[model samples]
Target: MTDKPHHPLTIDGEPRAFFGRRSGKRLHKGQERLFQDLLPTIEIAYPETTLEP
Candidate 1:
């Protein structure tokens, strides 16, 4: 698995703040699988989104 940052946002009247990742280590295989499976169910998708590290 790879190390990546995840930021979860709450969209209210004007995209209110919610929860997110500041920094962390890498994830093991089990954790990676869980994140991959659950992300599609709960993740918010925005067009043209890109990650800059």
Candidate 2:
């Protein structure tokens, strides 16, 4: 049996880690269409009160 490759659960012993990239790659044609059509309806508006981090 082959051993599985390990991915770290945390970074520098921190509880959470950021796995996503900052500069996003181009989306597929279908994805681009969905983003244009559906994203506006689902996007959140800022509330009057301040939110906690």
Candidate 3:
């Protein structure tokens, strides 16, 4: 017997893989504040190469 492989699976017609929990307990006030305040600065943004060159 072989162990089942661990991989992400996508259902038909979906654009991305379907996996993981969709919902969880609501974030506490502190957690919410962190997300709101820090997310903007920490998030990734693609820079235009032409502008930089």
What's the lDDT for all of these models? 0.63, 0.68, 0.65
Query: Model 1 reaches what TM-score against the true structure?
Result: 0.32
Could you tell me how far off, in angstroms, the CA of residue 9 lies in candidate 1 after the best superposition? 20
Clashes of 1: 0
lDDT by residue for model 1 (1-53), tens: 21333434345424345467657899999999989897668966666968666
By TM-score, the candidates rank as 3, 2, 1
What are the runs in model 2 whose C-alpha is more than 4 Å off?
A: 1-25
TM-scores vs. true structure, each candidate? 0.32, 0.38, 0.42
lDDT for model 2: 0.68
lDDT of 3 by residue, 1-53 (tens): 22434543345533455467757899999999988998778966677664554
Off by over 4 Å in 1: 1-21, 43-53
Residue 14 lDDT, candidate 1, scale 0-100: 40
* Candidate 2 local lDDT, 1-53, one digit each (tens): 21433434454543444468746889999999999999878968898999989
Candidate 2 similarity to native, TM-score: 0.38
